[model samples]
Target: AQSVSQHNHHVILSEAASLELGCNYSYGGTVNLFWYVQYPGQHLQLLLKYFSGDPLVKGIKGFEAEFIKSKFSFNLRKPSVQWSDTAEYFCAVIYSSASKIIFGSGTRLSIRP
Candidate 1:
């Protein structure tokens, strides 16, 4: 079965600190990977995504993720953080173009200023 797993249930960071969130997935064939962020009281927004081409993709707000197909890992990273970066991050995988997205347990990031 295809599934997505987020290893970190919660993360705490200080302003200007670096951030990394672990994500892994299980699928047989090619898949689409995505990182979505939901700020408090806001809708989920795409942080980054990988479909094809470059294994490393960059997203909004200085966020980036690397897709390692062999390991089935798509880890998100941020070089620097801010107080407003506090949000819930979700890793998702889609087996096919029309398949439903499987979302991992979200990681809630709290940034202390």
Candidate 2:
């Protein structure tokens, strides 16, 4: 079985501030890691993913995440933030063999302009 843990429940930042969200997962076998974001009233959107190849993956809106296999962690980072970036972010782990996806308790981010 796979599980995810998000260290922060909520984060507040000013416009142009840097952002980093911590995420950790536990799984024995190979799995897919993903980061998703949901705006105030919008549907969840994929932020970045790591299935294979490079550990560093970049997503929309200048967001990027790095998968650390040894530590079983995938942390998200953004160089600069905007008020429009306020949203909920979730970390997900998908077990390829079982085709099951597990998500971490989301982290809500609020950006002040």
Best candidate (score: lDDT): 1
C-alpha root-mean-square deviation, each candidate: 1.2, 1.0
Candidate 1 worst ten-residue window by lDDT: 93-102
Candidate 2 regions exceeding 4 Å error are none
| The 10-residue segment with the lowest total lDDT in model 2 | 93-102
Instruction: Give the TM-score of each candidate.
Output: 0.96, 0.95
lDDT of 2 by residue, 32-76 (tens): 999999998899999888999999999999999999989999999
Cα lDDT over the full model 1: 0.94
Which numbered prediction scores highest in TM-score against the true structure? 1
CA shift of 30, model 1, Å: 0.5
List model 1 lDDT by residue over 40-94, tens digit each: 9999899899999999999999999999988999999999999999999999998
